[model samples]
Target: MKAASKKTAGTIALNDRREICNVPEPSTTRLNKRMAELGMCSRREADDWIARGWVRVDGQVAPMGLQVAADARIDVDPKARGQQQEQVTILLNKPIGYVSGQAEDGYQPAVVLVEERNHWRGDASKTRFAPQQLRGLAPAGRLDIDSIGLLVLTQDGRIARQLIGEDSGMEKEYLVRVTYGDVAADVQSAFPRAQLMRLRHGLSLDNQPLKPAQVDWQNPEQLRFVLTEGKKRQIRRMCEQVGLKVVGLKRIRIGRVLLGNLPVGQWRYLAPQERF
Candidate 1:
């Protein structure tokens, strides 16, 4: 996306480090994007503030996707920060049969389980809920309908960007229950050492090599998988390559936050002090 000219609106082209760079094109780009590139907030939040006339560039109120130099000065009213502070991030111990985002094929989204009554009683966070909290709340990362464990949904773009951004490096840990497909050995003995090593380092999906993953046996039937990148149905596919069938999967952690004691179908707020 090219940035708009000084008088128009356009898109931003981000470099390898995600720094916004000016393209040679004359048209201007989206102002929300420029704000996001500056590390202030997500594009969605930027648009909200821009609509409210909370952003200014070069001493003038910013218009939608206003074109400016890559290094242009942009100022946001302090009110934006206060609104961002009220945005919430929710942690759910999503149960099986719930989709992480929108509903599909008659199955419900995990967010529907986040009603006030469903708030975890053991949660230490004191944040209370309002009907508006559910508005625009979205899953930051996906949890498969067949899986159970920690799933994040947030109204804060900063948290969403940190967890699922294209360049995010946060680690996600899972406990997967698998079974041997071959008849020669039970779950414990069927997998060879070489195959396990491949699960850790030597595999590719869709012709692209996979990033190194931490794959280890947790018990006779369970494997612990810690990965930095998520491809569609990645773990199950990796196990299939090793002649193993996944029977169950559960995510336990994301970065420093743990699934903890949040019961299935229940959710809690990410504490103000929490980083992930």
Candidate 2:
């Protein structure tokens, strides 16, 4: 006797003649793309390999723009990974007069901060300056060419984002040495005893009381200024308005990072775990 038919499960099957696989498709993607997803080679390099017929999929030569299953046999030519692993980060106590990124008339790029002669034997080979690395490397933040202080240059993107981001909230501290002409005691009395002065009355005060400055006697004529923000020639400008002249300006710290005892014109590799 013939058996009775079962009720339909109500699922419609796709009926396309071009469909090749009975397997419900492994989320179709390209071989070159798959290689890139595996962190093997860049997508552009992967495409070039495919064009050269060097890329294989399940043992068949693949073409540029060919589509393949997400999981496919993939291999990259030996040089595709290139020399990116040797990326480095250098921290320099930048001296006056070196532009941070690109060289301009009469001045050198801060990158020269590490001339070949300065490269220690253990540092990466001359290939350290390879073009691919330079594309991602830059000074994470700036120190004006006229100023002297700790400047950071790095190949890492995360640190750069942190240092220059608007909400970075990093405190940069400076020690400014200033000298003042003899001012009548009345003028001095009108201003707070802070190393920075606020024009309290009948005065032009533009800055916000100069960031809550601290005053201390360095000598009868000289005062030491410590500040958190490095506005343009701010110490010099402030001193000029108060009958004083800035003789020296030096940055001592950025966030918890310090200038330490590092000598002028020298640099050190940032410790691998160091940030901010």
lDDT of 1 by residue, 68-135 (tens): 77767889899999998888999999999999988999999999998999998988888887889998
Which pairs clash in model 2?
Answer: none
Q: Which stretches of candidate 1 lie over 4 Å from their true place?
A: 1-30, 182-186
Query: How high is each candidate's TM-score?
Result: 0.86, 0.52
The lDDT leader among the candidates is: 1
lDDT of 2 at 55: 70
> What is the model-wide C-alpha lDDT for candidate 1?
0.87
Clash totals, every prediction: 14, 0
Assess the local accuracy of residue 207 in candidate 2 as a C-alpha lDDT between 0 and 100: 49
The 0-to-1 C-alpha lDDT of every candidate, in the order given, reads 0.87, 0.60
